[model samples]
Target: MSALEAVIPTPQVIERLPGASFKPLAPAYVRIPKPKPELQQEAIRIADLLKRNHGLDFQVAVGGTEQPGDIRLEVAPVAGVPTGKEAESYALTVQNGQLTISAPRMRGWYYAAQTLTQILLRSPEVPACRIRDWAAYPIRSLHVDAARKYFPKSWFIRQIDRLATLKINQLQWHFSENEGFRLESKKHPEILSKSYISRQEATEIIAYAQDNHVEIVPAFDMPGHLGWLLRNHPEFRAGEGEYLTRMLDYSNPVAVAFLKELIDEFSSLFIGQTQTWMVGGDEVFPMEWIPKELAKRTPQLSEYAKRNLGPKAEVLDGYMYFLCEIDEYLRLKGFSETRAWSDLLYITNLMNLPPRMQIAYWTQWSELMPSTQKLLERGHQLLNVSDRYFYYVISNRDDCAYKKHVEATEILRNYEPQVFSEKYPSPVAQARVLGSSYAIWCDTPETEDYEQITRGIWPGMAAMSQKTWNPSVKVLDEEGFMSQLYLLAKRV
Candidate 1:
């Protein structure tokens, strides 16, 4: 039999190893040859943790190069350990009462270190025998949309650290929206200065997220949901153009210039090798306003409304043009990835997007299957975020029993089968399902009492996380999951 087949545990055996009962092998020693400062620090931290928590010496050493042995805890044991190179290999061995871990590169070593932590934390018994493992998804992601409702930076980073513990790699930050503009934009100071309560606070949160093994993908809602920006700068709002107006003057050249400058400023603030900019193109309501303005400017523009019953078609056309302009501006500024709500597929042909652009399929509406299908056929990557299953906001109120929220319970009940099941075939033709995200909109959660919100959503979100992480993983029972979630939340 192959090594992989040999290591596969039987269902009966797997059932015995609950997440809480897992523990690492003890009385271990780690060896690293010519370790850099970061690796060295990690080694020391592991050793200290072992000594403090388990009363094990957990010795660490820097020594001459050697191949890694099979083991749960492998310290770097080789000289010439590469740093920052992608796709490097690592090995860990625990054979004949000796344990060794070695990597050709530092990134590999870092990964090995993470794996060691997981095995140590998640296995029911100490891993006394030889074992080997590696990452399956290079881009394992967890997204938090702070734009809709801001979360404390401390809470954000704490969650990042917890995600790193689970080996999740990417943290997508939905940073701007129509409700509030969360990031600082110096070029258009009006964007954040007037809309957001604090800009430096948002930057501090980004810095904290980066420190905890998470790559932040910041999103700014454009074209349609520029209401927050328009609220701050009346000139950017459509004529009748009062501050707090819901629509932007997309036809105005000055407004376009302001948007371009804001995009540039955002690009500069988040300058990093791994950062991605998400420009949201979703939910353009009040189509009547856009066409009314257009018809007033040029009576002949009324001809564009031929397909539709009213002037709404002209308004939608103007909105589509605005979306394309934002897409082009971001492309020119070196941002390859731009995400929008799934509706962008139906409202406008996102055919003008750069080849690298990605669309987030926010399947909140019931009739989103067709739109999702069209987006995939158009050759764009999609992130599935079905609200019924993944939205945390639709939960029981504080005074209500969990079952009292019939709509919320119904959503949780049907979410899994509806979104991920083979029975509900993907609407997208090509099926480029990048992953999924659970949106925790905090409109009613104004008091910042996350405990109640979290408690209400735990069982559902945990199931969502599992489905996102491993599609074939069995759906867990609610009671069993809640018991586990309580333990996990305490750790967080």
Candidate 2:
């Protein structure tokens, strides 16, 4: 196989030079370049793996000066790179028995390491390749529904390691909504009655991800899909109804204050660490903004509007009101932008919206929810997630194991993120497409030990990566993708 087919999300440029090779280790021990103590972990990490995989020992040492040698790792600066690729772009060279990877920042270095790992896995003895690569989207992420399953810290750390291996950089921590909340808050301690994720534990997760060049964005569903947040505190429940599906009552000044304080608490924990915070305003009943459960059973008007009722303007007032407050708070709290479902725009006419609000937007491929063009015209930046391409959806049934689940590879193989550009009118609006993500909602029984959660996401993750990185999917040959998958299977 050619060197280009060796890497998933196929590198932009891969040139092979005959009779070129990189001997990663000597028979006795490889004289590895020394990384600074702060970065020594990565050096030892790579070296130890090479030792285990290819049989060599590295003499352990702590601090040492870094310089060019058989293997060189660098952190360079590419200024004013709003293109979203340059910051993480890197060039790798393997020629004349030497190997080197140069990147703009620490994260770039981490991604370079991922590419190098994939290389060594295939050609551990004498690898021959030269490549320059970057991603099409600035933010390629995975959203894990930890709130539903209560994943352990170790589980998350392992997943982080695996994601970084794929060169997938962003890890969106979906910490709350529906069943239970996985975030810790002193103000709203009840949210963590299960203690799914503690403040200290969150810090550890953040630090580990940062070390691996993964940005973990913290989120807790709000306004809609309250989960159990309202069962205990009915004060937060929207309009009096019999339906168990409760959403935050935006009309209540007290409820709004409660949400603001809750957000402030969670925001303080994640501030300064990430640019985006997900204030979930997604999937709220669109028409009356009430629980759909009641409509399923009761056919009434005043029965559900939750006291916040009126014409278009008034219907949107309560929901938009909290969004306005949450966006401003997040901005003030060191978050550069906020992400919400594109559905947030559906309730009210796109006449006026907080221009700063960004969207984690998607539509059912067959039945696109928010019009891609309309959302763009309304002037909202997007983290495009076409449910067809990105969502590994499963029946919410407690027993819905992958029995009849659709293989995501089928949809993703033909899907590309660049199609979003067509929906935008101009280059300016097109640029608003920030990146894209894939999500796996809980589909297993609460007591199940979590063996089936990754079934749908695994192979599909690589496909999504390739589509986002190599947006021109049609140009890619089928043989190349199958070979890519074959190589990935061995490592995964």
Best by lDDT: 2
**TM-score winner:** 2
Error of 2 at 94 (Å): 1.7
What lDDT is obtained when candidate 1 is compared to the true structure? 0.50
Candidate lDDT (C-alpha), each: 0.50, 0.64
Cα lDDT tens digits, model 2, 1-492, are 554466677777777766557665443322224446645566556565445434555543443442222456655543333465787787777766566666675566656656766666666544566677777778778988777668888878877766776778888888776777777777777666465777898889888887777888876777777857876787667555533246776656787788778877777667666888888877665434233433443323222233434433334444566676777877888887788877646544523557677777665322324566666666777886656556665455655433344454564555656454234323334467777787766644353454455444666776667767756444346566666666655554
Q: How many residue pairs clash in each candidate?
A: 12, 2
Off by over 4 Å in 1: 1-30, 33-61, 64-93, 97-125, 129-142, 185-204, 239-244, 286-318, 348-351, 364-370, 394-424, 427-431, 445-448, 453-461, 475-484
389-479 in candidate 1: lDDT tens per residue?
5555533367522223223334334543224322245444223566666555654436446456545544454444444433333433444
lDDT of 2 at 134: 77
Ten-residue stretch with the least lDDT total in model 1: 4-13
Residue 248's lDDT within candidate 1 is 56
